[model samples]
Target: MVQDSPATRARILAAAVEEFSAHGLAGARIDRIAEAAVANKSSIYVYFGNKEKLFAAAMDRVIGDLSDAVPLTEHDLPNYAGRMFDYVVDHPEALRMSMWRHLERPSAGPVVTELYERKLEAMASEAHPSGLPPMDLLVLVVGLSGAWLTSSRDLLAAEGGDPYSAERLATHRAAMVEAARRVVDGV
Candidate 1:
């Protein structure tokens, strides 16, 4: 058995993210994750107990990374939306893994719950007088931020250019930020 360490654990989680993003929790294979991580299957089981737990851990890790990368700026919702759009554009797999969890798990784990609660609290504490409640505002902002990236291919290809090209991404990011501003500003 390969020795277990923090590095090995991190590798497993990273590989698991890729696997789960591609195949989802139901279709993800432990052997493939272990092989991708250059670790053994026993290490994964020892570290995460089972495939489901591993998926949870992977989700937590990716969400944590996103939070760290783009700490919520509730005070500047538009900038926050733009930053989120940038993050997702750079790391689409993270969003894919999150979508898989939503479909297969359908329950927020502790880390996700805590992070979401924190964001809600922050939004509630903000002095802005948006018409919508904090939870709804947050949802609106998040939805607007990810819309371009998650939209159907037909909609994306409507412009007859690479939807993910730099120019198109900038345009979408600008529109998302403006939408967030309007939603938060109640305009």
Candidate 2:
């Protein structure tokens, strides 16, 4: 059994996220991940097996972290959106990685599907309204994230702007939640 420090694993994961985000699984290079991690390429292969596995693991870690950060309860919608926005602001790489994955349409390996299903289940459980279909809620949540990521620059450029400013973010968060509530409430 090889002993690996948590810090070392974290470094490797961080490096993997960066590399994968910049270049999809197809374009990402193991050498770059090794260089960024300060770990030998052989070590990455030994630990993660291959670039595909490493990319999946890195994405899984990020998704898990994000799920933890954004609770799914209806009461948590605004806060959840805010946290998501905060996450994108802090980890733009994650967003880039996601976009790349969507664009590439890579094979849905176990790790990818499992994490995605978990998120869908969580979203269904949390946003399950009395009359609304679970899929609708799912779409709403996913759409919100998509809109934020896609329109972030435009939002930031608006007059009196500062999309990432705390106050503006809070306002946007509240508005999004209210919009969701209105739809869910059938108002």
Candidate 3:
């Protein structure tokens, strides 16, 4: 066994993110991850215990970066949604990992639950024009934020050339923000 080191751990985490995002937890291969990370396959098991734990660690890293990049703004959900759209555009892998998590591991881990609870508390502390419950508003805003990304590529392509072009992205971002505003303000 190779001596454990922080650098090897970091490489493993990075490789795991790419692997899990592309194949999900069930389909991900530790051999591929080890090759990508230039570490022994056994290192992953040593560091993360198993595939499930490794997936969780990879999600934690992605979620940590996402939350740090785009925090929840309870009072201005529209702007918050816009920011989320922007973040997803920059880090599409994060979205893919999240989708995979929902598909294969539907339950929220403690850290994810804690983060969600914090957002719920923040939303409940404020009153919106729509008067919808905090959880409902949060779900709506988040859904709108990622709606474009989750849309079928064929559907988007049918609209025009390069659905992900700068112009299209700007247009979708504006629409998503407006939809979020309508939900929050009932306008």
What TM-score, over all chains together, does every model reach? 0.88, 0.71, 0.90
What's the distance in Å from true for residue 144, model 2? Answer: 1.8
Q: What is the C-alpha lDDT profile of model 3 across 1-187, one tens digit per residue?
A: 5665998999999999999988988899999999999999998998899989998899989878998899887788899999999999999988998898788886633366776788788777766678899898889889999988999998888887998899989988998898888899885
Task: Give the 10-residue window scoring lowest on summed lDDT in candidate 1.
Answer: 106-115
Cα deviation at 163, candidate 3, in Å, is: 1.0
Candidate-wise lDDT, in order: 0.85, 0.68, 0.88
Model 1 over residues 72-131: C-alpha lDDT tens digits?
Answer: 877788898899889988998778877887889866443556777887887787676786
User: Which of the two, 1 or 2, has more TM-score?
Assistant: 1
TM-score of 3: 0.90
Q: Show where candidate 2 strays beyond 4 Å.
A: 1-7, 74-82, 105-131, 152-160
Order of quality (lDDT): 3, 1, 2
* lDDT comparison, 1 vs 3, better candidate: 3
The order by descending TM-score is: 3, 1, 2
Which residue pairs of candidate 2 clash?
Answer: none
Poorest 10 consecutive residues of model 3 by lDDT? 106-115
Comparing 2 and 3 by TM-score, which wins?
3
* Backbone collisions counted per model: 0, 0, 0
Instruction: Encode model 2's per-residue lDDT on 59-174: one tens digit a residue.
Output: 77766666676555544454455566667767787577667767774442224456556766765666444356655665675567546556867655875666667787667767
